[model samples]
Target: MTLWNRLLLGLILLSSCWLGLAVTPSPVATKPNVIIIMADDLDSRQLSCYGGKNLKTTHIDALANEGLKFNHIYASEAMCVPTRASLFTGLYPVRHGSFQNHKPVYDTLKSVGHYLADLGYRVGLTGKDHSTKPKTVFPFEIVTGFEPNCVAPTDDYQLNDVRKFITRTNQPYCLFVMSINPHTPWTVGDTTEFDADKLILPANWIDTPVTRRQFVKYLAEVRRLDEQVGEITRLLKETGQDKNTIVVFLGEQGAQFPGAKWNLWDVGQKSSMVVKWPGTVKARTETDALVQYEDITPTLVDIAGGKPIAGLDGKSFLPVLLGKSSTARPYAYGIHNNIPEGNPYPIRSIRDTRYKLILNLTPDEEYYNRFMMNAKQKDRNSVWFSWIDQAPNDPNAKRITDRVVKRPAIEFYDTQKDPWELTNLATDPTHQNRIRQYRQKLETWMKQQGDAGAALDIVYAKKKE
Candidate 1:
């Protein structure tokens, strides 16, 4: 063997080693980045992936198709401020002190921004900024991309800021892209795309001309929301963060229709969450395991490699993400207060996988929502009136409206059999044991959380927004 031939072979081996090192994924590139996109006043049932008969939600459906579909995720409280606060603090509504709309969280609590940032991640938020208040607590790097107001006349937006924020550095990030769509006035989307006549009304709603017209407007905003999801996911792919990032899509709460929002029915309480993590979560999978918004932060912390924050009511569901087990919690609880929205109508609820029990504190007094049932001439377009106007002759309409206004102190439902919660099984003798058990669990949870029962339903001095 010649000395030159041996030297040439050694040089070739060294160059090949350097080439392999260059192509290996960097540590920063492999670190998980989280992007959570949330929708406003959405009816999970309105999405085609969740079995909606309305217009197809192409982008959102794709997320469900490619990620884990959470069949039983819920917002601890159905309102905006409370739900987001619960999500940030990993605490229930009462504990977070944002139990009502426009209410603020306890000024002392730490948020996901603090938790993740301490662990060396940039945490930022864009659009629909509600719970990011008292900047000292939330501390999320404020970025502008989507609209902040839910009631704005227009939703024109630019993604330049969002694009810059996510791709700005190699450091891992947690960015929340909040979208205010299908919320109120329902004026932001292309209403022309939907035919009011052909839309399929939810079984719980009365089939009326006005109801159909109002629903078409709602679905249009839902379409706009779909576009927002599509764009955000596309941005991730464009930046080459598609494979390593953990992407989540959340439906904030139910629509604003009567008996939908500000009530304890499944539509208002139940939300949709679809998550995708390349190489971690299995694609085209689902879990009936119960999860709530309160559990989200702890899971994020777990993803950040941190221990559970002591004293938090929520526990991480990282195992569920890894497909380690099917169950996260045995019961998911609920609460509602109708003070700022209307009169003092307080409610509490508890449910497992199959059954739900609701306790209406003041069942005798009629339930009212200032936004939906107001007598002002301007509110004439609300679908609540359509249900009322047709209630006289339409037996179906009469049953539904009466059910909405008059509530029994105790209500129970087999949600698996009745998805919309149309039948109240409270009086059914067969389910007495389930009702008793759930009520006991409900009382125990309330006591632990310092929930003041109906006393929490009074008006508070308005805080600075």
Candidate 2:
């Protein structure tokens, strides 16, 4: 062969080798690791990252600074069992049918953990597992990827279980860390020490002497919860999985206080949501887009490059997190129900960016008075109760208490003007047109979703007097 032909042949071979290297798939990025950290009965207002001042949550704040923070996030329901069930199934409480805290509904639907395991990703749940009955078969029968380790209803053993799993796992995995901290019974000393005086009361809540005192205790509990979160994040870093894993931190429901946990108010359904996806999400980008707890499953599925289950009530926010602008949810729905011996059947609400409308199906005075009555029994000495009990004698207290207790069948609040929802505009003639519009929207949604409330006789028999 000629020298020129030999040189041409050598150059062509080199070019072919470079093209092959460029076209190869780069290992597919290994199905990113996922970690969901859930706090029980935590309020968004209690987190420093969410404009809270009572406790310092430096670790969570750091995570928020590194990723996306959702301002208008909501829970599926204002109660534990239902909210967690919705998170797993990407459905509503009525559809999943886990109506109360003691009722476990994992058997009725597939869990996100199980789906991930089926797709070859290791999955495990540590800490509180409130989905299944104490001895009922969990959705994931064999722990296909990682062993199941959960905290006892009254014990803190799950923390160690989570640490062990992270340390031992050798494959890409998903870990659901459910913390029992910050739930009711307000005890101190489990995780961190905090002073009561540091707590800040919400503007809507009465700033009476009693309310201030209760806030102190509540603030301490929030700080302790923050420490637990810090410990978990530190473990991720220690295991060297912090950068590769996407961490989602949020609350299961609102605080377990009056008009908070078992009510449809913002305090009951609003949650603190922070997502940290090291390379994907932007640093400290905050969006007020409405997001529901059910959206969590779909979001994770998108991140894993897996197809979402059909008939899901959630939409993925993957585009928004990837720095895409002009992404937003139209509206968010919330439900409140099934407190032990609590009066009234149930309530539902829908909120857009500017306004919130609530429908009280069983709007009886007796039912609305149940929470106030319970407060008197649980904490007679509590400043909150003392102020309410003395309302008749104190004109100022009466003015505040009466307005909340005598709320109407339909309630409306211009969220932009009254974010705290202390004032009700349901009866005001000025908001009549707005009320009709929202009521129609709520009705259309209820009918389309086939809400059990529509077929109460078949789904939920009326109670005897």
Candidate 3:
């Protein structure tokens, strides 16, 4: 057939397939590629598109401009292993048996790798294999490009393997391009670009020289993460998979700052997810529909023409992605077990769109994280000591330090008015009713997940090989 005649016939066939007249299973057309780029220890609120006053994340903002930005996505457990374990398995931390940092998911559990691969997709992960355990459970084609170590001093990476993986024509791909930027030792990106004195600090942080220096490093990595986003999306476009791929950018928990990583504060549990599904998800839009890391795998499964895996803690939020629903869940839950990272302090939280309730399972004990609060470390920037040093004169610094160590039996905050959750309204008589309801809901969820709360923290958890 002539070239023009063949092109016309191809267009007619595609039109008939869309109209359900002739539904032939075209592997690439039926199953869109899924590329997920996750940032390590990311404080997503620092991104300009997320109301950040820091440097404009031009690359990530471009994705938000071309796709949908999620406002209420959370990490559930706030720790690296627990959060990622929950994400890969679609189960809460306790249920998956990775309730503590560095802990492994249950051996018998199934991960997104198994689920997506079972559905005929080439599932793979490139970096940060914290959740890729028990190879029998997670059989991802190990791609190489990004650095996998979170605390590596240098984050030099090449995209040769990444380009090859996305360009393959045999099957649709679900690639997790996890970036270990902005993690501890924050030495990956360009700190020269940020003026430490002029940057906007978090509402709850104290302005200290050490803190500012470290923040410049952290924000630089955030910029690096955005650059990686730009590179990956550009690869997709060059390979002609941009229109047939769903690009998801995840700010994996929060940064490794004292009050952010191992705690239950909003800064710790809050995460970000931006989805770009060309011709499917609406562009230049935002959603307040609650979602968590646990919901990610289920949504990917749904998108790959598979049903929601029953018995999973997360449900598919594809409806929210497609703008078919305004809400996904009534509440987003958070869990924190501070054993491996700190003293035995367990926290459970539940938040709706407006209010957040926190239950400290061991309130009498002071909370402590050795790495974040260390005062004796000389080689690296121990910013926590500077906060303590300034606390004597600066009341805000004192409040911030005290806020990290001290605790209460119950803490509640109106997240709508106080996004940082600075004030504890648990004692307010007017909010008592709402607090009680959230408490009941949180307790029920804990029970459902078989979470022992403070008791689980007493055990010393170790990483699995």
Best by lDDT: 1
**Deviation from native of the Cα of residue 450 in model 2, angstroms:** 2.4
Q: After superposing candidate 1 on the true structure, give the runs of residues whose Cα lies further than 4 Å from its correct spot.
A: 1-29, 378-380, 463-465
TM-score of 2: 0.84
Encode model 2's per-residue lDDT on 257-331: one tens digit a residue: 656777788888888889999878888889887788888888888888888778888888888778775455888
Q: What tens-digit string does per-residue lDDT give for candidate 3 at 189-234?
A: 8889999999999998888888899999889889898998999988
TM-score of 3: 0.93
Each candidate: what lDDT?
A: 0.90, 0.71, 0.88
Per-model TM-score versus the true fold: 0.94, 0.84, 0.93
Give lDDT: candidate 3, residue 394: 87
User: Which candidate has the top score in TM-score?
Assistant: 1
The worst-scoring run of ten residues by lDDT in candidate 2 lies at: 141-150
Flag regions of model 3 displaced more than 4 Å: 1-29, 461-465
Give model 1's TM-score versus the native structure.
Answer: 0.94
> Which candidate do you rate higher for lDDT, 1 or 3?
1
Question: Candidate 3: lDDT of 6?
Answer: 98
Clashes of each: 0, 2, 0
Tens digit of per-residue lDDT, candidate 1, span 1-465? 799999997888789898884434556534599999999899999899988988899999998888899999988788888989988899999998989887888888998998999888999999999889899879999999889998898888899999999999989999999899978878878899988888888888998888888898889999999999999999999999898889999998898988888888988999999999988899899999999999999999999998889889998999999999999999999999987999899999999889999999999899988888997853655688888889999999999999989999999999999988988999999999888989999999999999989999998887665
